[model samples]
Target: MASSYVEELLRQLAEERERADRERERANREREHADRAERKLAEEREHAEQKLAEEREHAEQMLAEERERANRAEAKQAPTTLEQYLRLIQQRLVTTLLVESNPVNSASGSVTAVNEKFYPLELCRWDDFEKQLERTFIEISSVFSSRSLFPSETDILGVQRELSPTSRKDEQDIRPFVRSAIEKPAERIVRAYYDLTNRPEKFCFQNNAYSLEYRDPETEIERRSPSKRRSPERKKSQPIPDRWGICEEEGGLRRVCVGEYKAAHKVPDEEIRQVLDTASKNLFLEVLWRKQSGTTNSEQDKAKELVAQILCQAFHYMIQSGLLFGYITSGRTLILLRVDEFAQQRQARESEAQYAPATQLATFALLALRAREMPRDWIVQAENCGIYQWPLVPNPALHQNISLQPQTYGGETSESSGENDDPNDSDYGASQRQSRSQPDQQSRSQNERRRSPRKRTERSVGEYCTQACLLGLVQKSPLDVSCPNFSMHKRSSARGKHPITKDDLCCLLRKQLDRSLDQSCECLDRKGFFGDVGVLFKVTLTEYGYTFVAKGVQKANERDLAHEMKVYSHLVPLQGKNIPVCLGSIALTRPYPLVSMAKVTKMLLMSWAGTSLCYNTWPEGVDIKKETDKTLQTLAQSGVRHDDIRQSNLVWNAERQRVMAIDLQQATITSVTKRQASPPVLHTRKHRKIARSSSHIKGIVI
Candidate 1:
């Protein structure tokens, strides 16, 4: 029983060990599967996160596109009403102010000024105050916009705020209300100023003004007597026009009688003051009118007349006030009155003057008139006329140049006229004498014409030709030489056959020589006529019927005349030889000119022989014939080769009587390499034979 129990225990132990091993193997497999699952899940999570990010990016891009579209749509909308445009104007004004202030004050100062001055004014109704504000705003806005004060992304409103009154506080503080009201109009006024004052002759307000004494026409009175004038009677008193009453007060003297009683035209000091005060506006209008009319002399004249009238009215006012009588000396008043009357008369005359001849006069008259009506226009017109227009009031410069007297007005004028007489008397007398001599000179011219008779018949050719020929002869002769007896010569020529004169020969030779020289020089200078002996021979033979040749007179005999040709054949062609051809044994009467043996010998022995000797004696390497032949052969080959060829070794064999090339012993053989197979050897002997027969043959021992 014990043996059986032990055996059972062993079996149980074996069974338990096997089961535990199996369970351990199963757990190991489970962990490997879990690891694979975790890796897969992580990859999936990563992909999902990437997808979410891409979707978010797409949504943001869509939103951005929507915003851009909205901005473009808004930009297209227009603002029509004043109220609707107020915001835009305000914004623009602010921007302008800021830009202008950038070079001056801080941005904040500009913003503050715009806000205080422009914003409120723009919101208000369009009145003078608002208009002025608008003008200022426009100017400020323009300045800022021009400077690109706002970023591209920023709207106009944003730019305005950026460059508002805050940017320039100091400027905004002084006359704050006026500044605000005039800001818009200030721009208009500034633009007007630029336009008006653009030229050197422009009428500028700062340069011109109505005199303090100048009065309105409504306030001016006519003076019948010099002093202690009585009031005009009711019948004589002129009623003030209604238009004049608009700005004038008429309550000085009740009445003044004319003729029997002393009638003084009166302009109270107050009226003068009023006119002077209004002159600025009136002057501006006048300038505007002149500008509109395009500144013609007529317009200028009209402006001057208006100015003079205005000044005269002002002066009259001063006279009535007794200011001219008390403060101004009589002499000065008289001068002023004279200048005034002169200006008035000029204006009246210019108005009646025609356009053509009176342009300058009208211009001056207009300028003078402008001085009174529109002080600014007057100054500008005077400047345009090249005159210095100064203020009529007390100025140091004027005082230095002008005389001031204190006698009665009319008496002072008389005294000044007497003072001016002495210097001008002699000049006046001289001018009178000159004027009286004019008629006598005219009578003398008439008498001279009457004494000389005129010819009506046509001039004869002989007479005309004789005179022309005589004049030409005189010109050609020395100044010291007396004029030849042309009359006697003319009579002799008419009595005989018209001789071929020296002049006729000279004229013919001049034309022939000029044409021949021109042709010869052109051929020599341009056509390479002397480059080759062949070309030289051809040109000489064709042009001058002369050619170079080396030939024996008889077979086996030395060359009698190697180079010879007739000097003249059908035509005389230009030859290139240094010496002209000698005409020998060549009958001019013959149909075909024949050259003589002696002449041929001389030409050949002289020029052609010299040329051959020089060619033979040339340095070995300097042989042009050999060099030229080598050059031609090398050019014919299809490989790299040297071009150092020349004529020294080349020779003309007397036996062959043809040029030949020599000295090929130092010639380099240019071998062409081939990709597929060795290139075929060129048969140079065959080419040489052909080339020998060709123009570039090498040397043959003569």
Candidate 2:
């Protein structure tokens, strides 16, 4: 039975071996197939690369050949001045074989040339050649002398002459003709060349070779019209009087006859001068009086017409003086005007009148008021008046007291007062004094009556208050004294009556209280006499609780007081480097607050310091130890040379002890200092002695 069992086990093993063989064979076959496929793809890629390279070479060769052919074609063509050269070459090449076959008809046959070589044709017509030459000439001329070929000045003058009046048009046209004549030499050379070489040709066909013969008469017909004939002149029409008038002809066309329309005789100089003087005076009065005194629209219209007439007279005067630049007559009015430059001078005169001086205006008003006796030179007299003064007084008493200067009008005689004058001015002075003093007396009486009752009540109240306190034998507090238990009392005692809740106060205290103060104090007891160090105390009341901070020093100074306030003011509700815990009367000052240092550090590092903290102490999901390790690693990598790495400055938070790099004025970011160096290595060795060998040797010797 054991043998059979062993045999069965051996058979099972063989079957397993056969299965392993089949699996190995299948894997090997897949790998070989993959290899063959990769080899075939590589070969196909190589073949494609070779084929593309061959095509690129072939394309380059074809492009080179095409460029060479273009170059040869361009070399055969030459620039020519004659218009018929291009057409002649094309016609000769196209009809050359046919022309050469009919040699007997050469004299009368149509001829053309290409490259200065003749072509003779028996069936070709001279009219056809002439037409082709004409068309070629026109095309060549257009190509050579395009629209831009004409001089700009000549073109502009031609257009202007077309639009000018008939009398001026002839003169404008003559300018361009004169310019064209000056440039005739160059034009003649071009014309001669065009006529000689651009004409139709005759040819001779001798010994089977094409040759040129005498030229044939061109068959082109001139299509331009002949010049018109001029008619003889008729007798001159009779002249009308030299006066300006507008005439309407039969077709309703209006014609201006200036000669017939001229005034029969010039208006008399004296009459014209009188009209001008009247217009000027009216215009001056209208402008000046309208400005001073308001007038109706009808009056203003009359004033404007008079001004227009004055302007017309001035314009005519300018024309008569030969200073008029131009004239334009519209109907009855002949506006003899000057250029804008000369008109500005006239405008200056009108503007001076329009904007008369203040003294001139005042003088005009005075003259108008005293029109009966006012002289024409009153304006000049007023201008010469050195100073004019007007006095204003509250009463006639004061007015009479002030002296008046005597007036001198052109050194004229003075008139004495008449019998109407009074011996005493007492009636007038008394009336003026009564009028001025009445209101003041009434106001004073009213004020006295209004105040009497309030004064009596105030005096009674004062007597009653003094009597009441004296009767009770108890003193009343002064008004300036404040009541007890007031919130203002604490504020006044600590930081003055001003509110201490302001942001500037908080900021100032926080910035100033970052340092300590030293103070000295002497103490005496029954047991012994001793000197005590006066410690500086900085206290701050925050949202959480009151904190009493003590700085251990020898004495207190101004800097200590400032530092205390600075640190105390910046303390958060429940945060800071050192927070005081209130234990009954005595407060226990902890090294740091139980607040998130990382959050406080972040708040302090922010661009604005007034924002709230973004972290909390004992924060969930925070690993303080891991974060501390990371911070240390980062600090090491950043080469931050930290000196004050104590628990106070390095606050412990839930996630991390935010390292507040304090006292940076003394610390620098540099290589590690001696205090931060690594510990030295120490080595110890274990000893194994050979004392047994010496003892055995001694026993053997015995």
**What RMSD does each model have against the real structure?**
39.8, 54.9
* lDDT score for residue 591 of model 2: 14
Assess every candidate by TM-score.
0.17, 0.14
lDDT of each: 0.24, 0.24
Give lDDT tens digits, candidate 1, residues 1-702: 899899898898888888888887888788878888888898899899999999999999999999999976664343222222333433344223221224334223111101111000000011122222234334434443333221122343443444435322332232222122212222222333233334112111111011111222222322322654445442232211101000000111100000000000111122222222223212322332444445625533343333323333323222221111001010001011211111111111221112111111112221221221111112122222311112222224422432221122212232333323321011110000111112121123423323321110111111112222322232232111121334333343434322233244224323432233211111110111111111111111112111222111111111111112211111111111111111221111111100100001111100121122223644455555554455345433523232323442233432223333322222343553333221111101000111111122221100
Pick the TM-score winner.
1
- Please give, for residues 1-702, the per-residue lDDT of candidate 2 as tens digits: 999999999999999899889888988898888888888888888888888888888898888898887765543342333222222222222112111123342223211111111101000001122232234335435545422232233333343344322221222232232222211212322333233444221111011100011111111111111443323343221111112211111211111111111110111122222222223212322332343344524632343333333333332222111121212111112222221111101111221211111111111121111111111122122212221111111223433322122222222212322132222100110000011212121123423433331111111000011111111111111211122222322443333332232233324324322221011110001001101111212233222111222222111122222332222222221121111111111112211110000000000100000101112343466564564455445444444433434322233321113422221111234543333211111000000011111111110000
Steric clashes per prediction: 74, 22
